[model samples]
Target: MSPAHAGRPGQAIQIGRDYYEGPLHICDSVTSLLAHYLDLLDRGAYEVGEGDDYIGFVADPYESGFDPELLSGGIPHDVPSGLQAVLIQVNAPRSPLDLTPLAAAHLRRLDLKRRPVTDLTPIRDLPIESLAVSLHDGDLAPLEGHRHLSSLDLATNTTIDLTPLRTAPNLHGLDLSQATVQDLTVLADFPHLRYLALTASQWASLLDENKVPPALAAARLSKRDASRTEALSWAARLGLTVGASFVISGTLTSDSETGRTQ
Candidate 1:
């Protein structure tokens, strides 16, 4: 099989049980990673790969905790329907950094463990044809150069600002839930976005199919349980004017700062 390439932000690339046939591109920054040189890597160690058929990569930091052996070398994650992509989680114990030298390693590259208390730069522009930003159930820092994103899943990352995505003309799918974002004016800027899902109280307002733009077609919104909902109610009560035809799930928070804690 050729080098495995990651999909665009939200698009799916054709793949077999062990191959990803996207645009067949890779990044120069990755091929140079130090992890490429070691014939054998330590579990929870950094990984690397050559560009060849490789499109881009994902960085899940949590994986290091669940499977310490994943860090030893390239970890390929083949999702349902022959879909190949990376699945990185937050940082956990026994995870390494600086994986830029293992040319033989084409990794699933899950886990984004490296997060600073003050800030985190958003992803920058890359040549990736198909990529999946599985920031699901996680928090995302500021994103940078994302010029070639196609399928992006910011789901569960309610705090992330999708405005930067306006630059990604190829974006098709987007998901942001459980995050702190109140409005989705950023999505209105995209002319090509096709599918979107906001399954949280925070970003529910962005699902307005009417005012959200014509490119949008399918969407789903879910809220947390009574033990879950919080500031989202204000948007609904105030009649912020969002989308329709979607069942409202999740909980609504109490009134006042007293409930701020447990």
Candidate 2:
């Protein structure tokens, strides 16, 4: 709604009667929306911190930049079409601000049990680190500019053939929990990888404790009722900030806050 189109005091502005409506008057192109949106954000129109509740709001990327896939139950599955993005907060609030839109598929929380590693493929020209494009049961096909990705969160996504990761030089963090991942040698491709969280991952067994010599960013690895000393020791050796946590006999625990390794 524009100011010039304001009808007589308190009068409703009907689309048909309100006047000729088109780009001639006001066009909501990506640029326009982005300008207003950023202004709103700069002035604090919305919260600055987000956690998990925000999903399906803006399910796609801005019309301008390269957008990634918004997967749902499986590979062929996707979120509602017209959706763009959403606003919410993660369960663990890092700051009072809630500014996470989860763009490019940075999915943090939700019910994904139904979404299994699938019979589908990843989109082309996408994969921002913040996005969560986890392939539940399939492999993410390589993109044109594969190494440009910043982060790829495929936690618990099994059946993932991360050949694409070889090209993802920009990749920094990865969450492959309970998924089918075999080697970190592929990760050697990502020299800048800092934060890594692999808890009870399918490849946990395959991971040669020696391979994960830290020197990266913060690391969080946990498994079924595990004694995190082993993982922590490896993390320390690599110079990574380690925060090991996991579930044990229905109880949740972390090595940092708790002294016992239950």
Candidate 3:
């Protein structure tokens, strides 16, 4: 748990099996249980700070200390300025969500988890550079002219089309660990892509078709299985650095080693 989630009887932050108990009140929410998250923006609690990647918020009562009334009240309508990077994890039923309110100029990174956003038209004009979102099997067509989108991470339970994403001129990194695609040839459309990640099964299908993206600098596989050896061999043949991540006792761990294959 992050420092913000541990609210007190005995305040403790867990770090690699060690717990540090202290007086820390980082919960930015006004109420002990979340009435809404817009209050955090008003209080200037949404900023991720100078060098931090992002400031995260958990909307699931089971996952965090507070209850996010997202079911009763939808996501905040407006994301205030100066909030560069923000990640909100939600637990709710599948429903349409409007993302136009989050299209702030200074907001470079936005991550929405478990969101049932079916349309991307609302965020078509966002100036965000990085986006990690749950697609609800959403189409990537709305991002056609998104020039600043350098990185995109998608979470979907079904296969999605990658043809729409090829329009991004600066797209360098893509994560499709939770998604699948029938046509691996579309990956060649991304001319500037350097990093790619996919599930072991997806990689196998690509390898069998001989359609791995040629310009990739690195690749990561989502699961560990017999297919990993073939992936490593494929990466080696392409002189690319490869890695894999898997769950070990409910803890996420990686077995990635640095340096490119000769």
- Put down candidate 2 lDDT per residue, 1-262, tens digits, no spaces: 2333211233222234433421111223446646756666566555434685542323223322222343321222334322222222223222222112232342222223333323223334323224453344456664324544555556443445555665666567667664566564565455667877676443344255445523365666656565667666655555656675565577766687667665
lDDT of 1 by residue, 1-262 (tens): 2343443343322334554333322322333333432322434344445755532223432222223334333333422222213334444433332323212333332233331221222223233334344343333333334555566544333365556667666677765553455457666777888876664543445444334745766654544453223334534533455444355677677758677632
Q: Give the alpha carbon lDDT tens digit for every residue of 1-262 in model 3.
A: 3322113343232233332311222234335335445556566555565679776543333232222332232556655543444456556646766777656534556666556677878667766677887787677888886888889988865677888888888899999886666576788767789999887667768777667776888788767674757756756645566666454565555656854442
- How far residue 177's Cα lies from its native spot in candidate 3, in Å, is 1.3
lDDT score of residue 136 within candidate 2 = 44
Q: How many residue pairs clash (N, CA or C atoms closer than 3 angstroms) in each of the candidate models, in the order given?
A: 61, 33, 0
Best by lDDT: 3
Model 1 TM-score (2 dp):
0.42
RMSD (CA, Å), each prediction? 15.6, 16.2, 12.7
**lDDT value, candidate 2, whole model:** 0.44
lDDT at 158, model 2: 47
Q: How many backbone clashes does candidate 1 have?
A: 61
Deviation from truth (RMSD, Å), model 3: 12.7
- How many collisions between residues are there in candidate 3? 0
